[model samples]
Target: MLQIIQRKRMNLTLPRNLHDSLLKHAVFLSVCLPETVRDTFLVDPAVILIVVGVVMFFITFCGCIGALRENIRLLKTVKFSFNTLLFAFLSLMLPQTRSALEKFARKAIVHYRDDLDLQNLMDYIQKEFKCCGWNSYTDWSWNLYFNCTRENPSTERCAVPYSCCTPVPGETVINTMCGFGVQTQKYLDANKSIYPVGCADRAVMWIETHLLLVGALTLGLALPQVRKPRHTCRVCMGGRTSRRHQKGLTACWRSRAPTE
Candidate 1:
């Protein structure tokens, strides 16, 4: 009889322990998987860039509205949101900056093909030197074009003789003209300051910066705020306490009162 009782108790304890373990495992699995998936989605460069750009644009828009209305609260919110968006935008641009540097370096090498000495020097460095503790260009992009030479012989000299020239390829020239024209229209629509520079490279940079800033500010202002239950409860209690005090409630009674 004692053996039968002991066996039953052991069986009961095992299941309860197993149940507790499974519950804990389930909780871990639920939280960990979703977070991992979320991180995976967020790590994409295009997604991050778009998200930050949209946030910044909204915040800037709100800031403009606040300024026009002379609302202090709105202005403060706008300022905070703008700063946050700016930080995010900068973070997203880090990867793009690296990509741009790599692209530029590759283009430079192609453009300076006639300079065998420079090519040989680059090849030697690439083969022998490990930059940022990496054997290949996989680790660093900006370092690849560090102290590189510019294409133009004179700073004052214009590369293109005309708006449309053989020096610039037809497709590239068309794309530049179209992009600038579209951006010029956008500036006009917004009544914003338009840069006088007509050079393709300068114009492209300007447009990119403007677009990125606008997008980041916009999304920051529009993103929904996360609500914390504990915070909400505290706020409710605070208001109730203030109200009670206004009605001449004693400190002792308030201290002894149970929280709802």
Candidate 2:
């Protein structure tokens, strides 16, 4: 009888302990899994770029097909849509949109580890521009791992990424730890270790210095869209055009027409 009682207690205690252990592990995974997921998908610009590429290819393909088929309705739709996008892109230079762009830059820094491509791009920008974070070196604090908060558990807390570090003169190998604990120092002191300037200001200065080149590129891209549709429209209305007009339009479209 005593043996039976002992066996029953042993069975109950062992199962209870196993269940508690599994419950503890479940709670730990629940906390840690979301953070991994959040870090990965929080702000992936590559995905956005992929989506935009697919959309632009679809639009441009439709435009080319419409022009070839002499489909007036489809041609008009493409022209209108293209113009809308062009104007919208130009409007990004406006103050409100520029501010929004700056906000995006900050967010990009916050999620710097989310995408490898973005991380590499940011490192290149920082190294080439002699800049640090988006608005300032301190902007790295926006990243959870780099945050200086007392509650943060990251080993990288209070440190900047290696890309922000100033290169050593004539060093053959890169020093990954050069930026360690940089955020704990004063600006004057940290400036010795990392670039003090912000990438946003450097980018703006670059654009301003190359304003003419920027304008020329914009016009170059826009002119083709603007002129191609006019040629297509004239070709579609060939019956109304004089022989000279028809010949000129045909030559223009033939010269610049999109190939399949």
Candidate 3:
């Protein structure tokens, strides 16, 4: 009876082609899974940071050696410098690092904004982060404006509306309504609805910090190169002149010395 039952079960087993088809379908479904699931489950910011740091380290190391060796070739030096700056900037400005910095800034902004004391808030930020002036307040004000006004805008999209400064709020209102500006108040309204105040603040902070760092690094690295003129052989300096005159050049003994 047991043998008979086993034989019946074996007979009901799926054919090889059917089994393979089912497996292929399963794999197809797996392959088409949402990207977010993979991002959420497999992505590691720390690993990315480490990889970027390593690349930057290598570039800086190579650049230092090339510079020390006095490799006067502009192409080599420029290439090295560019790679060094790119990798270094990546290490500092990666999305994860920016997000962390933004989170800190957002928390600070929210805590202070909630107090409704702009002066105190500015003072606190100035003391803590060494950031001062009306720009900071204006940024917060814009943040509030966008947050209060928008409906379901993306954080990335909200910045567009805040970048412009119209003489009157009505102008801004009109501009937004007409979609005349890079960012409209409608977008801002949308972003505000979708995200919390803290998220916007954080995103802004990240962008500001990373941009400042990138600007500083770019200036620091590029200014010296720009200020210094490239050294070249006399022949190279003459450029087209050398090419044109090459066939007509007299031998040193054939040319007479100039009279004083």
Best by TM-score: 2
Q: After best superposition, candidate 1 residue 15: deviation in angstroms?
A: 46
Write the residue-wise lDDT of candidate 1 on 1-260 in tens digits.
99999998887775777787777657644542332334334333456578979977877877888876868887899878767757866887665865655453444333222344434444443323211112221111112122122422222122111121112245543332221222213323312222223223443455687997889888787664343434445455556456654344344446545789
RMSD of 3: 18.8
lDDT of 3 by residue, 41-113 (tens): 2223444467879877866766777666755564486697787777977886674775665554443333333
Clashing pairs in 2: none
**Every candidate's lDDT:** 0.43, 0.77, 0.45
Looking at candidate 1, the ten consecutive residues that score lowest on lDDT are: 156-165
Candidates by TM-score, descending order: 2, 3, 1
Ranking by lDDT: 2, 3, 1
As for candidate 3, its clashing pairs are: 150-188, 150-189, 150-190, 151-189, 151-190, 152-190, 152-191, 153-190, 153-191
Quote model 1's TM-score.
0.22
Global Cα lDDT for candidate 1: 0.43
Q: Model 3, which residues run further than 4 Å from truth?
A: 1-42, 71-195, 198-201, 205-225, 230-260
- Which regions of candidate 2 deviate over 4 angstroms? 1-42, 90-93, 217-260
